[model samples]
Target: METLANLESFIRSAEHGSFSEAARWLSLTPAAVSRNVAMLERNLGVRLFHRSTRKLTLTEAGESFRLAISDSLSGIQAAIAGIAGDGGEPAGVLKLSLAPTFGVAHILPLLPGFLERYPRIKPEWHFENRQVDLIAEGYDVAIGGGFDLSPTVVARTLAPAHVIAVASPGYMADKTPPREPADLQAFRGIVMRSLQSGRVRHWTMRDVTGREAPVRLQESFVVNDPSAMRGAALLGMGVAMLATADVLADLENGALVRLAPRWYSDAGAISMYFPSRTLLPAKTRAFIDWVVNAFEAEKLAERFAGSLDLRSSRSG
Candidate 1:
């Protein structure tokens, strides 16, 4: 029987297409991961990877073998954890992927309490803007919006991702505020261009009564990041459409005012994602429950929902 270490090395190497990346995720040296994979191949009497300087490509036999064992690996690990008394207390490195600004503003603040409750579990978090492949990247959990849900992953919604027009109070003070989405055309716009597509994003604003209107801003300032756009708006440059969660503090502090308060663009839901498995790691389960409970206690779901914005009640 092949050792679990050797099997794990092979599987991770295959998933990452590089021994160095596999080693990073496995917390092993590249040489160690390579040696274990070589040992596995020797025991199986079949080569699993095409060795190259750039990347390791799976051989036909390797692909077949990976398919056979990939699903079983999680179950085996879970069983081992259970036997090792993991169920009694969660203790391990919990890897997470989170959006940069949102993570720092919201989730990072929760870290103190989370660490207090689960001191044994060390958090390894990456702050990034792009969506990650949770299973292939070996992340314990990911928090973001608009991730394509794969069959192997599960998404639990934390809040509505609603985009609303906003500007610094100074900017809107001298200008007639937008009454609806179409009225937004009158103001100078701070807009975001997609880093991947290089195209300015457009939105359709909707009201509480299910009314929709296309929104096109007069692009006075173009930025690739939401944070930059918010900064520009704060400088009295132009009106910006931003996620409610991103600017909630600014709005509450009266630094920024919502334009067309009754209108918002539905971007989807901010979600916590994890691999779908028969049994999750105790650390992952604990973190998930903790976040869910925190969101509930804070009523963040309602706060992040533009359709449910408190200002909307007083707006025409």
Candidate 2:
């Protein structure tokens, strides 16, 4: 019969990719972990890992087994913790991957209240522009758009990832704003290069009547980060197609003006992602519930949709 010790050893080794690293996590010696995994292999009658002196790699069979048992192991650990009184306080270091601008602007504000409510929980968060592997990286949660989903992950939509062209108010002051998507070809453009792909992304924008057009602008600068692009646009450098959520403050404050209020690109939904459908830790569950409720109460999706012209509303 296979014990949880053997299964845990196999799963931890698969996650860390080494017996030594797995030993560090399991608080056991490397030899002990290796022996446990070997025991598991003998019990299952199949080799799980390709072991070498330098490193360890999961075989195809090992990967399959890891995926199958990873969530179950988490559930078991969580169950044990719950029984051990960890469930009541929701205490732990909750690690999260968040987008640089949006997470700071929107989600970061919610943390104070969350911390107040759950005083035992500690947060360790990183703000970046790339997709992180949730399971392999040991992230409790990741908040972003356009992440590749795995079978062990779950996502909840926060908002529509709407993007539109914007420029500094001073830049648009002396120039005729683009009345149609085709007219943007005449303007100097600040564009974004994909950090993951290292390619400049093109925009396919649609008008109020659902007329879609691919407008290639004259590129003045290309940046990898959205905040940098927003900064450039605010400096009257060039027009930029940016996510509405990212530049909501600028647009509302008249630091930037919309090139075409009706035109936007529906990139995808901004979502909160986390590992596993079952046995989420108390800290993870609390954060998810809190953020979802906040988004709903604030109607963030509608406010950040980029269709409303604040200047027009103020004038009226």
Q: Which predicted model would earn the best lDDT?
A: 1
Reference-based TM-score, model 2: 0.75
The lDDT of model 2 is 0.86
Candidate 2 positional error at 280, Å: 0.7
Q: Once superposed on the true structure, which residue ranges of model 2 sit more than 4 Å away at CA? A: 1-43, 46-87, 307-316
Candidates in order, TM-scores: namely 0.74, 0.75
Candidate 2 local lDDT, 147-179, one digit each (tens)? 898888999999888888888877877777777
lDDT by residue for model 1 (19-78), tens: 999999999999999999999999899999999999999999999999999889989999
Error of 1 at 24 (Å): 40
Local distance difference test values of all predictions, in order? 0.90, 0.86
The reply for model 1, stretches above 4 Å from the true place, is: 1-83, 312-316
Q: Look at candidate 1 and tell me the lDDT of residue 193.
A: 96
